[model samples]
Target: MGLIISIIIGLIAGAVAHRVLNSRGGFLGNLVVGLIGALIGGKLAEMFRLQVTGGILDQLVLATVGAILFLFLWRKIRN
Candidate 1:
């Protein structure tokens, strides 16, 4: 289902972002972050009129970028 696919995408993207950012929070937190990032990324893409025909790969890229941005903002806000 679509829901399952989205969760899988989010989890993978979150785990990668976690390692890349070297930030705190465990797997579950990361998963939550990732799902949020996917939503953010979708909005951003829509705003910019950017469309990717490449399915999950494109979703992963956008979600990862969004996750990193979200984490960066979170750090700044926390600090």
Candidate 2:
């Protein structure tokens, strides 16, 4: 299902982002961040006119980048 795939992608993306950024968060946290990151990444891609094909790889990359950016900003804002 579409929803299931999205969740899986989100989890993977979040985990990857957390690993890359060396941030602390559990499964639920990663899922939340990943979903939000996907949204942010989608909007950014649209705004920038980036051609993101409907592929798992593309989505994963975008989501990971977005998650990293989100975590980075969150840390900055919190501190």
Candidate 3:
């Protein structure tokens, strides 16, 4: 159940990030980005001591922001 939820969040977050950044990574790529972003987002939230409400919407926002950051950094490094 937890894994399923994570996957759904990841897909949504990744899609949102891709849309915001105007990137064309496909479904699997977005999933990968989103999953990794979740990890990064979790760590960042911890580091910053951000308040989390334990809601799906909060998780989605965090994951989407992290995915955008990840994509931005990835592009910088790639270029």
Candidate 4:
């Protein structure tokens, strides 16, 4: 259940990040990036003491943060 929810959130977050960053990728690629982003973002928030959880909106926000950060880093590395 949690995994399923995370996947959905990741998908949405990835899509949002792609638009924000003007990045390109297919659905599967986005999902992978999104899942990775969620992990990264979760850890980052943890270090910063951000209490995120308990709601879809909270999860989405966390995932989005992760996705954006991941995309930014990837872009920097690629360039």
Candidate 5:
């Protein structure tokens, strides 16, 4: 199902982001970050009118962008 696939992608993206960003969190935290990132990425893509395919690679790309943005904001706010 689409939902299931999305969740899997989110999880993977979260893990990748956490590792890349050196974020401190467990699996659930990573998942939350990834999910939020997905939402942010989707909105950003829409705002910028970016065209990305509905595939795993596309999701990963969006999630990475979202995660980067989230991490940047998180650091700024935490400071």
Candidate 6:
């Protein structure tokens, strides 16, 4: 149940991040990015011992941060 919620939040966050980052991609692309972002964010949060309350907003915040970071690195690598 938590995982499902997290994934849903990740999808929304990824889509929004794609737009904010001016990323050109389709729905699946956005979903993939967002899912990866969620993993990345979750790992970082764990490492830092950041206590996320396991809610939609928390998931979105974490996913957005991760997505932004991913996009930044992606652009750098592409360039």
Lowest-scoring 10 consecutive residues by lDDT in candidate 6?
2-11
lDDT of 2 at 24: 81
User: Distance (Å) between predicted and true CA of 46, model 6?
Assistant: 1.5
Instruction: List model 3 lDDT by residue over 1-79, tens digit each.
Output: 9899999999999999999999998889889999988888988999999999878988888899899999999999999
When 1 and 3 are scored with TM-score, the better candidate is 3
Candidate 6, residue 14: how far the Cα is off, in Å = 1.3
The ten-residue window of minimal lDDT in model 4 covers: 50-59
lDDT of 5 by residue, 1-37 (tens): 9888778777877787888888776878778888888
The C-alpha stretches of model 1 lying farther than 4 A from their native spots are none
Candidate 4 residue spans exceeding 4 A from truth: none
Score candidate 3 by lDDT: 0.91
Task: Give per-model TM-scores.
Answer: 0.90, 0.96, 0.95, 0.90, 0.87, 0.83
* Local distance difference test values of all predictions, in order: 0.85, 0.91, 0.91, 0.87, 0.83, 0.83
Weakest 10 consecutive residues of candidate 5 by summed lDDT = 5-14
Tell me how candidate 5 scores on lDDT.
0.83
So what's the TM-score on candidate 4?
0.90
Where in model 3 is the C-alpha error above 4 Å? none
- Could you give candidate 2's per-residue lDDT for residues 1-79 as a string of tens digits? 9999999999998999899999888999999999988998888899999998979999988888899999999999999
lDDT of 4 by residue, 1-79 (tens): 9888888998999999998999897899789888888888888888999876659887788888899999999889999
lDDT for model 2 comes to 0.91
Checking candidate 5 for backbone clashes, the offending pairs are none
Candidate 4 vs candidate 5: the lDDT winner is: 4
Q: What TM-score does candidate 5 reach? A: 0.87
